[model samples]
Target: MTDSAASPIDRPSFGIALILVGMLAISINDMLIKQLSGGYPLHQMVFTRSAIGIAFGLVIVQFEGGWQILKTRRPGLHAFRGLLVVIANMSYFAALAVLPLADATALFFAAPLFITLMSIPVLKEKVGPFRLGAVLVGFIGVVIMQRPWASPEDLGVSRLVLVLPVVSAITYAGMQIMTRKLGMSSKPSALAVYIQTMFLLVAGLFWIFAGDGRFAEGTDNESLIFLLRAWVWPEGVDLWLFIGLGFNSAAVAYCLSAAYRSADAAIIAPFEYTGLLLAVFWGWAIWGEIPGLEVKIGIVLIMGSGLFVFLRERQRNRPLASDPPRGTGATRR
Candidate 1:
């Protein structure tokens, strides 16, 4: 059997460590993006960050096994995965421009639940009644956080704006599914390069279409403004922040890929929750944002249900969260 085909049981501890590091990097990256959202367009930030990330990712690719390792037979799937990631990043960051950081992060955590549901159709995985119920409970948590019955004034933002993270989560789950399929043939660094390249291309297109800020005129909607605002040449500290985002993106992509590649997703997936705590910290420390009672309750339910789903998958010995294709050798390069 190839190294990649070897059982994940061999390096589970290392996988957990990698996931924790990835979550920390992600939390920092999110906080930085949110901080800059008021002054920068989402696509501009994505462009800057992706450009730097591609540079770093190329270096990683060289260390893994030179430029040839970047080649893949599944170009279409890679492109689709890249598109999914772009959508996920755009939706989530646009929400960050207006919503509280912790709230956005919590809502996006529903991706695990979405993955469980999507697996039934996408991966042809059978989820038993218990996991199905967990999925339902998780959605309930989502509804509670949304509080659709409340007015926009009371909730502090439009209900429509709140949906962005959920949209991001769904697309993110789809991206993970694609990653599982692609993992068999691609190295994590190569995958990161593909994603960064996509970000660069899409961001460039956004610049061509809307970077002039003409579309942002007369819009009071904060999210729309974040999306349509004109790109300004970042100066001084803002320039440094944008540069930092590139490093963070490179770290996040590679660490997460390596984490999942190293072990069973079930064993390491729960560690991904570390981001929630980091989100809470960053939110409070930087913006004085705290989760209200309703949000706290929603977070509890969503987290509980998501964890239960992972546990159930583990017990059943099914790989719903991320079942990489079988019989492929490790493409560590």
Candidate 2:
């Protein structure tokens, strides 16, 4: 008999290994982005990340033999996925500008809640009371984090901070749904290639046009300075970090995919909240920023809701409390 290692199927050990390593890389990537955000233009970081990601995807495609492994028959659906990339990155990066990585990620963790609701309407999937309750609790967590209804002064809400991630979360949830639907027939590598290529194309065009417009329309001397030079060029070390960012992003995709192959997604899902922990630590270490109690409570509530959903989902997938699920759901990595 052929060795199990030589089989086409990935072993349980293989997938879990991929997941742990991937999460570590993703954590490092998030920390890098948080550090890089302050001095560099958020859009510039967006530009490089998408660009480098495309380059990496292209390498993957070529190795798998040209566009055959990369192209999907569904152009429109692929484009929609591409748009989600634009929206989610813009929103998350915008949030990174002011919010600590931990705080912002805590808010973004609500995607599963959104996805659970979205599945009902879009995919016509049925959700039980448990999941619904989880969603409600997640919303309460969101309200605490955002304080969206409060007066601007009371909340310190700003243009980019509050609006960006709300939309980013919705788009990210859409992206997940698209991946699931596409997974029915489409190749994951193809989907990754499409997302990367289309995202870079669109974001590059945005920088070419929108950025130039903003520069031309920039009113103050400070704004003009941003337009003229300072924002374009961060230090050399920061530029190299963008390559690490690309690898980190790729690691997240690969890790989550591998992890899911081994165990139940719901069971693994709660681990995603660990990113909040990493983000918090990074925030303090890099910026000396301490979140207020409100932020801490928000993280706890959000993380709690996610953990509940994950456990509930795992129970459903495995159909037994004693039985472990067969897929993992390690988020962001």
Best by lDDT: 1
What are the TM-scores, per candidate, against the unseen true structure?
A: 0.93, 0.81
Q: Which stretches of candidate 2 lie over 4 Å from their true place?
A: 1-13, 62-67, 148-151, 182-188, 213-231, 261-264, 318-333
Cα lDDT of model 1 by residue, 1-333, tens digit:
112332444478887888798889989899998999988899999999999999999999898778887777777877887898899889998898898888998999999888788777877777789989998999999999999889877998988889999999999887776666555546678878988999999999999999999999998999999998999999999999999999988988888777776777778788888898899999999999999987898889999999898888888887755544431211111
How many steric overlaps does candidate 1 have? 1
How much lDDT does each candidate structure score?
A: 0.82, 0.61
Predicted candidate 1, C-alpha RMSD: 3.3
Candidate 1: what lDDT? 0.82
TM-score of 1: 0.93
- Candidate 2 per-residue lDDT, tens place, 127-228, comes to 789878978988888888787667867766564476566677888887777556444233334445556666567656656665544553444322222222
Q: Give the per-residue Cα lDDT of candidate 2 at 194.
A: 59
